[model samples]
Target chain A: MSSPVNPDFLILAVQFVVAFAIAIVSLVGYRMFGSRTLFRMALSFFLIGGGILVQDAGNIATELAGFGPELSILGLVLEALGYFVLAISHIYTVRSEVGAEVSSMTLLLPFFAAAVQPSTALVLEGVARSVSFFLLLYILSENIIFLVKNRNAEALLPIVGFALLLASLFIRLFFVLPTETSDLVDLLKLAGFLILSGPVLVLLVRLRGGPP
Target chain B: MMIVSDILKVVKEEGSKGEGARISSLLRKANLPYNRLTEITDRMVSNGLLEVTPQERGSIYRITPKGEEVLDSLIKFEEFAKAFGLRL
Candidate 1:
């Protein structure tokens, strides 16, 4: 008899699909804009998607062997690196003049944290999450300032999107919800991504009507 | 380095005024060097983002429909960039 599919597998599949969609949209933006910042963002999303797929595979392997979350650390590290790259992309976006110096650093924090002290993995995860949170906050504040100075209505979209993302990150960092409500954080994060995707998709559609 | 988007913006604003603009006017408005402006305008023309016509005094440049569409997209890009505290 065929075995029943694992629910976790289904969840991972959905995550992979969303990540892939984000990466694809970012890639299209990169091509249209020819901006290195957009290129880095696309690469960041691709890494996140790859991390999800790897994590899913690791989960299946561990489940089959009766192991725990040990192997899943690989995926976690990839995700951390992805976030670091995302931070770098934000840096590039803010300071267009800095090029080679910005792209040179290779993020090894996640891997080092995983390899050197497996027992402190949670702490390392928290640290990485904190870094990402701060970077996102920086981005959000910049957006707010720009909106205030320019009074551009279109700027509101990204401000709202980044605010949602900041909220999700804040919840991840500070709140410890019960199992019943834990999924709320993930849903908020997903909604944040969907919100950010709106401007990107709109740009893509506009590009469709223009020259290649 | 001057961003291509800035050059596009200058061209777009000048072109949208109905009458085509002279290269000197574009240079002053775009705040770009002669060589750089020529290079960008050439590329834009080949990309169908601009239309160039020769007149008695000098060449006249105007934004095509494709150029307007691109400008609309660039405005969106500018919004995205400004959200990150960057210029498009």
Candidate 2:
């Protein structure tokens, strides 16, 4: 009966769907075709759990508690690893594209450190959480450079998803605070989340025909 | 990239050392139950992992230098596993 365009609410919905798709893909792919690397599988589970937890925390804080202050630090930590996994997925695309191999050793260090040390894990998680933002920024800058050099709207589509991801991260990082953050910041965060997650899912479907 | 194990799997099961069967015939003879011989040969060539040389008589099939290195590594892994009392 209700329309789904209330910005923050829409972002939450899209994030949930993206998270769900990621979980399914990770589960099925690892179970079927993947190398069955224990560490990487664990990482995938961590990210999926983090995504679910973040969504849950946001819901509890916003609707039930009305008192928002770190209801789910565990979720935050998991969310960090989730983004890191997503980053790894993007990196792995290089395997298909260039036929290059990254040593399994290179993949293990960051995850092992993230798992054993909480404080260090927190810092790493924070950095990893910021990845989509940086990727969006990179895409934006690159698109601008390309537009100036060659002027193509097609160069901008990939950045659409990156922008949405940046928006959601910006909200989590700067806006979703106690009671004093700006309404404008909150608005931007919600808008960014919806744009990044939902449109990116569509783009990925069209471009990759499924989740990466 | 194909692993050494995969290559050795091919070589060991499909290896044949007979004259009069040209390298092409040897390649045709070297297929597993489920392999695509042509694609495998293309891969073998691209990776510098297999070679065929034409002699006065007929072409000879030989593992390339790098292919030999890979085969040697696979053999070493096999020996190490055996020494460690592990079976796979």
Candidate 3:
């Protein structure tokens, strides 16, 4: 018997490795800063990253279980929901520094929305991706303002990292919108990973110079 | 301690005139000079003690809550240090 081709499985396997690395490095970054907010943001990223890994892993397993596309969509929705929470937490973190303020408890908005509509993967994924994009923008703008006001190398790193991260979201949106083939989206995700991960690793190194 | 000294120094560093010398006034009360009091403020901006607002040449520095806390801790330490006869 010819071995069945599993595209999602292959995609997830690659994503899982990269995402896992990002998560671990960010964890180390936050620990170096020793700031409460940075630590929380790192944890949120780890959760989202790990959740995506699981969602992909689950998608592969479901195919092995003879599950249909509908069940696989459910996995995507869960992953998206996880990403939504991650985005919200990240926004709260950057916003808090400037006293703009967002309640931590309000993160439930996306989580509750996701739980209510687990079946609609497209809708949930769109909402999650869009919000993450906006949050990345919000964070980037704040960092820019900070850089304008402070004009320091320290501030520049986060601004540069987050700007690329926001750009990555645009790439992601293109991938998600056309859903015709997974190839483009997977490539976009890899690009997003590079943009997001590279800066974070640099940030982690910078934080090491500060007092823990 | 150092954070307070940094705030005072940054305030003085911005200019030699205006209410900026309010920090100088306080340091004067402690018999500290605007020129010699450089040890603490240099580190405060980096330590997030004071918010450094950059201008054309120098920057306006304001004390943060972290700086305030450090000042309070310094004050208390000084009081205790005086009681123990350890000259500050």
Put down candidate 2 lDDT per residue, A1-212, tens digits, no spaces: 22324544554455556555435543443453233222243355457455555755654575655643343445655665555544444344224424323532344455565555556533644644454355345434543554455444443543464455466567755544653444455455445434434422443453343431
Model 2 chain B worst lDDT window (10 residues): B79-88
Name model 2 segments beyond 4 Å from true: A1-11, A22-52, A58-71, A95-155, A167-189, A196-212, B1-88
**DockQ comparisons of all candidates to the true complex:** 0.33, 0.03, 0.04
lDDT, each prediction: 0.66, 0.46, 0.50
> If both were scored by DockQ, which would come out higher, candidate 2 or candidate 3?
3
Interface RMSD of each: 4.2, 19.7, 17.6
Docking quality of model 2: it rates as incorrect
Ranking by lDDT: 1, 3, 2
Model 3 residue pairs with clashes: B6-B41
DockQ-based ranking: 1, 3, 2
Q: Which candidate model has the greater TM-score, 1 or 3?
A: 1
**What DockQ does model 2 achieve?**
0.03
Q: Considering the true interface contacts (CA pairs under 8 Å between chains A and B), give the fraction that model 2 also has.
A: 0.00
> Residue by residue across A22-119, what tens digits does model 3's lDDT show?
55654553454333433444455555566566666556565566554444444444445445444444455345544424454454565565456654
TM-score (0 to 1) of chain B for each candidate: 0.84, 0.49, 0.55
Instruction: For each candidate, give its TM-score against the true structure.
Output: 0.74, 0.41, 0.49
Taking the tens digit of each residue's C-alpha lDDT, what string does model 2 give over B1-88?
A: 2233454345534445433234455444554332465465557667776775669875544566677665554443332212111111
Runs in model 1 lying further than 4 Å from the true structure: A1-15, A60-65, A68-71, A99-124, A152-177, A204-212, B76-87
